[model samples]
Target: MKHHCNRHWTASVLICAALAACGGSAEEERAFVASGGPDTPGASPAVAGAPVYRALSTAPLAEVSLAPSDVDFPNPERGFYRFATDPARITATSLDYVVADGQRLVYTPADLSAYRTRDLPSSYLTKLNTGFAHLRKQGLKAVVRFAYNYPSSEADYLNAQDATLSRVKRHIAQLQPVLQANADVIALVQGGFIGAWGEWHTSSNKLTSPANKIAVRDALLQAVPASRQIHLRYPRDLATWYPVPPTVAQLLAPSPTAAARIGQHNDCFLASPDDVGTYWSASPAESAALRTYAQQASAVTGTGGETCAPPVAAQARMACEDILREGAAYHMTYLNRDYYAGFFAQWQAGGCMAEVSRKLGYRMQLQAVAHSAVAAPGGLLAWRVSLSNEGWARPMNARGLALYLARSDNTTVALPLPGTDLRQLGPRESLQWSGEVPLPATLPPGSYRVFLGAPDASQALSTMPAYALRFANADTAITGVQWDAQSGRLALGTTLQVP
Candidate 1:
């Protein structure tokens, strides 16, 4: 897929400025509604002097670069962490380790091996709900998977052990309600429930066939919420299921289709030329085509996985340079930090672990901002902001952006940027947003602090600071604009005055 690294937005600033220059008359002023409430028109008398426009810009610090962060901070649905856990084992105490380690995502593999031949029990479903509740309370998200068995021995791998197609379908139907209820905490669901360890291999019932795979795919697409995505084990599987890869336009469509929602996961990443059959192709041309498709598909839907031990000859490919190159190519969002211990040790010894940690997912930073310093009650508050994404991928989930005005009395007004989806902000991209926000005529006259925020798209978690996206600016001392953990906002180090 083509990488979109540069985008620009120009708001109707000229129109608003023209009206503001006309004595800021109420009749000429636009009717504006604050996010918190509707607008109330109030009359404003004409000013006697020229209109004053104030602007503020960031200053550089000697010690650090302002565009990308080196220190680690918890952001949703990204970064490295442990995978594979039983639902009932997740508890507040168990999560202490995750928090202390500076992680915000976990993988939950719900074991249904016992119920492969029958329906899922209500008690087990409740455990699933309870596990997600724990994650929500701890300010974390889960990469979910449902599997019948985890085969460890060579014999287990050789045997066909998963349930028949009918039983798998029945189980998905039973678990749909639980999945829907906790969609807020689920980052994405792995396309599991077939083969050993749910990696879609070694299925005794031949579930790997194209027909059976499509059936399972259809069921999963219907089971999960439209806002979430499902990840399959290999790129070839997607190529088989969807003979024609989706266009960049279709993948990024406002309402994505099932094909767009399916993503890729590489369990044995970088272990071999084809990652140990994760990209099975009969010819070099076919392999290139599958990889190109994965790159395009994952650029929008998202992709992730874990590393495996390479052979003696392939050890060089596990080096820092190789990993970094492939990571960016795949647009990887997360990985298994604890697995394949030797490779991680190599990363630490090679002085690339820190870089890997910071660049795994989206690293958004505020480059600069310009805005009007003073305006009448109903006049427009014009603003222009420059932002950059320094990481390897865009945010896989939905996010909403807004500009906020707050007074000393704790009164806050929000002006949400309509139709601004951060998912479109590709890796290594820079964007400029310029817009005019209409102020309510009845807004009280005062000096209000300005802030910018990227909060969750869901109303239930929008106000929670835990789910808010924090910028990569170092601190208030280095960059005048600082991250406010308490309010989940970036204090822009400027204010707007109203008379």
Candidate 2:
């Protein structure tokens, strides 16, 4: 059985700690709802040089050229330690204020546009540089929706589809050179409006005939180079096949029982109660009814009983999800969460993110999750550290965590601190360590070297567009550094274990 990922909200980390680690909103206000979307009345779309309700896909990126900030981490451990991750690409978010752990100030539609069009304060850029530098030292990549026409309703984008298309073409022309120029700012764009909140699909956008859907997807797939990545909204259903094996007739009749062609299915199997149970597991009656429905639907389409029964619309949102998931996957495109209308229309600052965190029983950060997938922090054997590397390219430049620990001998091991780094982290290569030190035993542990470097070498910096300056992974230093006390190493948590 497919198990649903545990849906819980992670509690917010203390802001007191984040205050120093995190930077202020790029401007007096955030430009757009970085997430959430659907419908809006009176919203106009982008026109040539026209200021739309939100910024377009083509916005200048905040140049991460500033000094690194030093995080004053606590050494003695007692309470649960905490630190905040920096915003990777704070282009012009429009996330309605989401009061997270302490307080999360997102952007408004107007503010998002302003951030893009207005000037960047020297101070803000300085602080941002501090964060990016720290993350770079650790070698990680940052993923953020720094550029987009997000938080705006799909209705407007779609209504303005002709305009939006032209706008994208223009944006693409500009982007090609900029992307070509920068090796650090990996920009992401979706082909057009997608998902419940623009995630990918679930509503009217999901209504396309398979053939049409494929056509639209193919065009998007062809737009960018094999090198640069384009982000897609999730519940992606561009190219998914059924789970059922080939028809029993084929299995029984042929020595060469090749798997049925993609999207090709046999409705004859639905005729048998046992076969139906084996396939979809519905009751005999449900099976028979599905078989009959498939036969009729197939006859209407002339595709030989388009057996959508097994891929029931009620349970199988496959036909729709494929547009995002498989389409992007096949093209090696990155997939962002399905930002949908349901989310945007109903989003309340503290309520929505908190609800999602609580539903999952934990807080979630898109960039952080991806980074943590590789290396997570170890609890204070008990020490906290703040590391900042201000270079460009690092570890695929993912953002998650960066920390360090000393061995009884005097060697220092780096750690990818939790919540401290995300997308912007790779650029910062910085980390602020926090938490009370605790050790299971007083005995001397082996000298260790820990630090957030890059994701494994399987990934290459050049593979993706050079968005930022990639950095070399941290070097192992201070082997056998002495520790102060006894300790039990606890697994770092992206999410806390809950009841």
TM-score list, all predictions: 0.85, 0.27
Question: Candidate 1, residues 421-458: lDDT per residue as tens digits?
Answer: 77767898888665556677678989988788898887
lDDT of candidate model 2 versus the reference: 0.26
Which candidate wins on lDDT?
Answer: 1
- Model 1 is weakest, by summed lDDT over 10 consecutive residues, at 55-64
Where is model 1 more than 4 Å wrong at Cα?
Answer: 1-68, 153-155, 311-316, 376-379, 440-442
Predicted structure with the largest TM-score when compared to the true one:
1
Candidate 2 lDDT score at position 354: 24
Prediction-by-prediction clash tally: 1, 130
Cα displacement (angstroms), candidate 1, residue 133, comes to 0.7
Q: In candidate 1, list every pair of residues with a backbone clash.
A: 160-204
Candidate 2 RMSD to the real structure? 24.9
